[model samples]
Target: MGAAPFPAGILIAAVVFHATVVLSSFPATFHLERGITANYKLKLSKLKERDRVRHGRMLQSSGVGVVDFPVQGTFDPFLVGLYYTRLQLGTPPRDFYVQIDTGSDVLWVSCGSCNGCPVNSGLHIPLNFFDPGSSPTASLISCSDQRCSLGLQSSDSVCSAQNNLCGYNFQYGDGSGTSGYYVSDLLHFDTVLGGSVMNNSSAPIVFGCSALQTGDLTKSDRAVDGIFGFGQQDMSVVSQLASQGISPRAFSHCLKGDDSGGGILVLGEIVEPNIVYTPLVPSQPHYNLNMQSISVNGQTLAIDPSVFGTSSSQGTIIDSGTTLAYLAEAAYDPFISAITSIVSPSVRPYLSKGNHCYLISSRVVLRCGALAFRKFRVKG
Candidate 1:
């Protein structure tokens, strides 16, 4: 797929935290770092592997109250593509490194009794498990809880007959899955004050304690402790904090593209005057956007508007977990044709393993600019 124009920063909601909060108070922001260190080819290959599985499936508050997390990982899609941050959980605060994904809703970690959880990681990070027995503040969520009811409706959660625990079994499109129960504990983070001073803070959060893993999740090649989803659901960490009035109900992120990968993930809205806004498809399970048309080098492609429409199984979704962009089958041909038509005469375009490959010489100058998308409204 051709490269699309990306905003300097992304804001999920319109209300900026700074404008909403009082002058005496500030909202908390979570800072995240990229964690991948794999080579370019390996990362690209992993992206393809993840894309194959993912195409199948598919915050906040306040205070002079800014929560920031120190992130680790690269932002370059060709290099280390996945970004993760450290979370201190439980009573005594055990550290867990989780991938920051905007595609799913729950925040889960490998538990002490987890079967098939990786003991070590190829990413060079020490793997740790969340042992509920070790944390004094940890408690298992029951099936009767309201959160569990919501989980049952929105996710793969079910009530276990034995002990009446809220158990979840998440199956990905790639055949990988995880089964576990819900656990509530304190999530530790750093609260920034006066834009310079930092203070430690903690909040009660509901998260998964994975007891079993299968498929790619069991592999140590690119493993992490768990996944921290920045989704728009009650079970997500962002919404949990927002319901508690800890921060605004929005989040923003800016991924740095340099080799030394690090970026900012704010639990609150980012105040940017130059940011463009697009309406999200309402009440959808994923972050679906209404894309009306595609433009290549100021020329619009002759693709149907319905190609990007929201339906039960079709829509344009923005997912952070996915490193590569995927076009719908209906728009693929037109997009490729437009891209190829604009290429220089010296450059050669070929097909390799079902992928559109381009061979351009060092001497050739390709003046390709932004691939723009026009957003249109869709009636619910």
Candidate 2:
């Protein structure tokens, strides 16, 4: 079924908005570097004063549009959806509007002062939720915290000191913005599932934690709460899932939108036959399924990774947050040309946008060796 991918932030993320966010977060980043030797640097790109307001307005209703699609279906047990949060900053001792990221391992929210401040200066919560101020051990870490001495290589003394505060800086895509540190706190997550499809079960996991806030975009998302890092580390959220026997690789997503609330994130292996399949065995520790080759009706494109300034091999990452496949120019060109041959130029643009777009009136097929995915239209 056709589905609309992410619908957020249209215009360039504005400069005024980022200026405030950056200035507010800048101090924490500085404070962090002094106490801890920077290891995995948060590689951030200079934020271009883009049309951020346009994008923010569009994204305001991002989750609403996907709900209109008509393919109500079942998701593989390993596939699940993400719960995203958008927030603001500047206020303290309350909910700092924050951007929630699950792909990360750290479990933190904005400190009460730093957390709710970003969200309309309004932090909404139910009764059982945490009150950052009164919560246990809720205080920013000083430069002298043991986390710094042990050389934890975390966000620094700011994040490690008080066991409650951790300075942080993280980056996403090349064109995407960046965020800086605030403090640490807990977070919450909810999963859904059941039935003979017993391999998958869903429940809500609440992380009563907070994290430092940061982001270059005015509202690229709310001040970042803690990241739900899946990597190895005691503080990783995966620790929580493993306790309940939830496997990591067994995850997927169908975020079509609010109407159906999209798909499930299976914590174990799940195979779905109907949703086109590509038998990818993966290249070692990559954990990623391999894309050995791509061909149209047998003839392949002369794909050279060096030309595009990227590896020529099919080393693509499967990310839920990414709306479409973003191929390096070298790879994208030939694929577009080959696919262009299958249909009129009019339909080529959409196909170039992603692997899922319609093929128009033409028949299109993509193959990975013997396995292939073909698209055809059936009229009622």
Candidate 3:
């Protein structure tokens, strides 16, 4: 089967749109911060003001064109997709900056008793822990309650009658994990009305208040208030708002390159005439897409179709939380070989960790129209 072509005149912009948080306002905008690098330092590059705007689109697109909710985001040289939004929590809401992730379901924040929570961040921004006791609107979720059952699976419902506080435990692929209980409180953010005009609104949202963290979550430089999960799970802030009839329960984001300030995140269906819609793989926990072929510079790599087939444990997942792209061994070898065979021998190639790197001190310039993603098309 042939892949559906994108609409004519529709430029598939490099800015990838996604969503991670939901607000009470019809259209809301949050300024994002590029997360700190693993080395605990901020990467700043000086560029011409016109060059910045030329290579990147500003929050001005939030109201018109292909964008709606225009949220400004900072740049992180280390991790390209680490975007966060600053919002308030509690009766008299205190501001917090939390990383936006789409691979998980729960919205969790480090609490006052966080054992491994960081006190400082490399982003040069102040970090604060959530104090549930300080918020009069805050309430503990009990294990016996229906909301607790909503969070747990039928087989995992082992509630303690003696202590009814609903508990949550989450583990990441990087050997990092967090454990804590749940709480409901007022979540506040601004809604974009017209152009930069925003109005404030608040809603009661149930989120995890983590008290313990391990691995990178404990690192002060990488830690923020917590993570805002925007997965498809019903427990996500998006689903919670939709269940309450908040605003049709939809959202989108446009992820910009490092040179750009960041991209827009809107809360509605995007109607792009030039957009091509692909069917998602069903019965999967995460967003999985069917990949048909792989190509580079318009040349399809010589690889078997079975190499891309789904196994019991491995499959194609579209996760924004992931910082890098990894190809299976069968496909990676030929992919690199093809690229190296075409390059000039004058540029010496060396192995750097797991990558084939070239030593180029001279400024090599390519035209704006040059370079393209793999020619492999995706189909059902």
Candidate 4:
């Protein structure tokens, strides 16, 4: 089984626990990134697919908003792409599917009267718009509220001219953005109590109520209800739960490579596993890691030493939103050359635009596959 980059940093393979208490079930909704799989089986070029993946990651990483609530869900690796989970927002508790990403923070959903929001989606899930008026528990956050000011990282908080509601404008690196205001409402989800029994739970969360969207955010084939950011921060769902003593400060997710629909996400620590721990780079935005060097088949790649330097600005972030591994130009050239040189004789390499495509047997696939994952020690 191939291991991908996980921000959570632990892998608990094939462990099932029986509950003495009511176990919470936060079932994850998994789907491939755009172009990974098509229900109609339409063939897309490799370059196009790569672009779609890149675009998705750029959007996912650039999400900035204000919301907090811990959620648990698992994803299927059938398509080997992105994974998402469903969240219930509002008093009646309408379900909305959002991408499960650790690179960004804050959870925002498309609200009613949203401009450029997708009317339909290819994932076959109904994209419901949230209306604060419909939910009895929902209320608009005022500009003078402490939660609204606490969530703002900088001077980006813009209140109404009449001192009414607080507004937020979340922008991406690619110029795409979401403009909305803040709202507070109850979020419904399943919480594990003791062992086997699951309990229904609800939390009061503050999240972005998007009124307008631009650029690729408007697409239908690749659209979902919105995005859920799981990044480490005071406003993230995990931190919010820890503050309330609802759960511990640690979490884990086990994503199965097989499409068997068997995966697990635990919000608290698992005491049985004696896994070694690595220190995280402190005060960084994402799950940044100081990768020492790159090794291939017992041989380390000869590259510039500064390329792997551990710094706040120049480290690697394990992002689940990314569809494939992206290396810097200095690393990409040498890595590609080494791999292609070894397999050139056996496999006839062809190009779909600039991408190298090859046909190989099952044996070669196993030999070339690499496994990598991250583990973190969550402390209160």
In order, candidate lDDTs are 0.73, 0.35, 0.63, 0.62
Best by TM-score: 1
The prediction achieving the highest lDDT against the true structure is 1
Cα miss at 141, model 4 (Å)?
1.1
Give per-model CA RMSD. Answer: 13.5, 22.7, 14.1, 15.0
Candidate 1: global Cα-lDDT?
0.73
Give candidate 3's whole-model lDDT: 0.63
lDDT of 2: 0.35
Q: Residues 1-380, candidate 2, lDDT per residue (tens digit)? A: 22354344332221231222335653643222222232422211212112222222322221211101112221221122233332221223233222223334344443344432244311232112235456443444434544322214433223433444434444554243323333333322322223211212332232324323334322322223333343334344454455444434333334444433443332333343357655534332222344545577688778753432213343444444433345555555676577567755655335333343443345763312111122222122
lDDT of 4 by residue, 1-380 (tens): 13343444332222222334333554643433443223333223433334334332322211121122233222322233456667888988899988666676677899999999898986666899999999999999898888778467634457887858888787754366787888889877554433222235777877888899998779776677887766776566666666766555555555554543224344555444465766777777778777777776667889787775556446667776543455665666667667667764766555444455565653543222222221222122
lDDT of 1 by residue, 1-380 (tens): 21333453432222112223245545654444334332322334444434333221212223534455656776454445578888999989889999888888899999997899999987788999999998889998999887787576576688978889998888764578898999999998765433433346788999999999999889887789998888887888888887876655667766766567767776766554577889999999899998999788998888888788789867888887655566776677778788789888877876554567667876653222122222233444
lDDT of 3 at 301: 94
Q: Which candidate do you rate higher for lDDT, 1 or 3? A: 1
The regions of model 1 sitting more than 4 angstroms off are: 1-64, 75-78, 193-198, 361-380
TM-score for candidate 3, residues paired by index: 0.72
